[model samples]
Target: MELVSKRAFLQMVSPLIQFKRFRGKINIQRPRLPHFEKAKYLAFTKPWFINPKKDKSQVELCKGFGEKLFEKDKENPFQEIIAQELRRWLTTSRLVVFYHHNPMNAEDEFKAYVMFKKQKMHFKKYGKRTLEMAVGGTPYETILDLYVSHNMTVFSPEPEIKKMLNITKKFPQLVLLAGILEGKLVSKNDLVKYSMIPSLQMAQAGLVQTINSVGSQLVSNLNSHQNTLVSHLSERAKQLEEDK
Candidate 1:
């Protein structure tokens, strides 16, 4: 201790001095993680306008919106959350866009929106740009039926969506813009016609009914022939007995 150099003493006590200074006085505040609140607010507040120059297609538009909603980082936590939601909608639901030509008053719009929400459907307005609606499919059931004979799947629009469409028809102001079915973009006319097509379950039931009717008619025809044959045989036997 008597031979201790000033620099050596200071170095040895530096750690202790720093520890004492920090003890019972140190507080840490972690930096807040990035979030999608701003992005989401912008999405909800703004309409999704089509820019022919920038947005070449709906797929491109969706991707761009997704990028803007989340961060560009490959492992961003907020991005993952957004990706999950987008995947769920894209896979499990049918997306449709409608043009709201006649703007509804706040009250009517609220009532209509609430009604749709009660049916497990939600619509978002992109101001005058586009109105998007997502109609979720039934749980644990295939929304479309595949035809093995034709190697094609039938387009069975969800009944809930059809009901909404019917409602919109009555409104006259809300017009169908386009629909995404089985990853294909369809025009409004096609969507409306598709909705009119019988669902898979209904088509199957109709087929079964027709088959049963045909089988029943065939059985009745066979029984009538058997009865006539027996009658003819009985008449011949009676004639033989009388002649004997």
Candidate 2:
């Protein structure tokens, strides 16, 4: 074999080396966290059971500390923190909990997260205004309805909770767990039932239709009586004319 100089060999392989380095960097990039647009309800995964504390550093780290720390703390620190956060958020807005076994892959999760962020921004900007424009409710009622609907729109899956009761695999790994409504913790079954119930708008529309139906029937009955009287008078007029 012909002898090759180190400089010549390195120069020949420079492009290949650069390509490998570029690939390494791409591989090392941290996966993006899931973003929830209008995430009226806060959700987390099984990881919450491991470290409930938002600030992981706060857990006192000591030499030889392991499972003992968890054993000593009867309650899960992570779960407590999550619960507290739920309470705070629920006070101002609506909240629900969801659990999933298989999380989305990094790429898909990141895309979903991006979409969520965009939706959240959009809701924040126009949600209130849209609620105000809604018909058949007082200002206070509309405002309250707006908050409820806003939270519903954010958390519930399509084709909306009103339309469908079952939690489908629409979002794949994400499963509906529990919900907090009107400052109460609702079980999964309750949540489902609640979702099945007609929304304020829907219920109102139904009521309006019922009232209109009753009014129409009343008007029809009155018209029938008038028609009968007209027929009777016409017969009487014909009989009198014939006698004359």
Candidate 3:
């Protein structure tokens, strides 16, 4: 048996130990070859369909991911119902006033409601969508522009233009914009002028008086012609008798 020095033996054994450690430390496996079926399936599968119109970019870009997430439902049933009711009001109400108003606390709003109700008027607040749905494609659509920004509405069955103006005066926060009287859209200035005009009964009475005066004058003129003819005949008869 050949004798080896302790240091030389340790050096030789150390290399083998290091080689075993390296082998254990490093997992030398071949690069995985994907299963043929899986590879084919992956290669043939459709690429994800990204929705360009989607508002967010995330898992939704994957095909069939949350298909219903972006789907739009129909208009709210309540909105439709309210819109129908509004259309009825606009059509049936004799006075529909659109007023621009400042933001009011709940208490003030309640007070306003009570005040309006006292005069047999309705106070309503509607969203633009509701207004659009109600008046869209109708003749009243021309007044749609007046429905913007913090708007409140007053609906009265009577064409109480003057009364409405007076009521609005009590609420300093409310400024009238326009009104629909008897299905006609009247501007603010026109509304003031309309309020100043006489009532329907007064107007009818004046018209009747003028017509009567014209008729009386016509009768007087007609009688004047007949009276002149009679007078001329009487004169001719008198002259003939005198000549005889």
Candidate 4:
């Protein structure tokens, strides 16, 4: 076979978004994929995902999720098979994904636009996670963009990966994950460092804003360590004011 079918090719390779290696505050900014919002608007779809009782077809449509009823079937049955077989190739995989399977082929741009709009609604209702972010602009809609201003490529494609390799080519701090991911010996810190973005994104977003625009807040999210840092800084400011 051609390594992977078009379907298998897309499905087998799980795109890893945040791998945890990017710890510490070295002043990395929020990720801004070029025209990400527009791409999301394009390939996004609101799949009418249903938690079927006996319907394998319905379950498989869910992308390996939902309460399954049939032994021969599973959540998102088609993808389940694809995921299971690809387990060998996707050994270091975190999230198995399919980004280009369009059951509803568009006849024209107008209809395609309509489908895209619906997909966005579905994505919003379902709520995206780090996994979805890892998969680029969601499946069958757009491929992952390898361009990241921050030299992180846990979720980027081959081209971007090359760039990442080139930049970290000489840095010992940046360990080679490609070998370890392929069952070669390597340090755990290397993996952890790559997975660092999700936490940082969560923290920085917390500092700058909330899920619901201004006024509302969610302070409890900060871990004990981060909380102590903020608290200490506040206390120090208060002491300085008193001394003055």
Strongest candidate by lDDT: 3
Clashing pairs in 3: none
* Candidate 4 structure quality by residue, lDDT tens digits, 1-244: 6655655744566787975556655545874454978868756763666665555665467755543433353246555444443333234333211122123323432343343333321101111222233333433122223121111113221112223344333333333333233333234355445445355556888877765544343445446679899899999999999999
- Estimate every model's Cα lDDT from 0 to 1: 0.55, 0.48, 0.87, 0.39
- Expressed as tens digits, the lDDT of each residue in 1-244 for candidate 3 is 3565554565433443433554345445865567999889978995988767679556656546566766665779999999999999999999999989897788888888998898899999998878999989999888779877889999999988888888888788888898998888888999899899999899999999999999999999999999999999999999999999
Candidate 2 lDDT, 52-163, residue by residue in tens: 4445563444423766655553555665554444333334544433343344576765554455444331111123333333222532232333243213223322213332
| Per-residue alpha-carbon lDDT of candidate 1 for residues 35-115, written as tens digits (9 for 90 to 100) | 689768767888676657673777776887787888643554654555445435546565534443465667776766666
Residue 4 lDDT, candidate 1, scale 0-100: 62
Give the clash count for model 1: 1
Which candidate, 2 or 4, has the higher TM-score?
Answer: 2
Cα RMSDs, all models: 23.5, 23.8, 17.0, 40.4
Superposition error at 195 for model 2 (Å): 2.3
Q: How well does candidate 3 score on lDDT at residue 186?
A: 84
Full ranking by lDDT = 3, 1, 2, 4
Clashes in candidate 2: how many? 3
lDDT-best of 2 and 3: 3
**Candidate 1 worst ten-residue window by lDDT:** 146-155
Indicate which candidate wins on TM-score. Answer: 3
Our tally of clashes for model 4 stands at 23
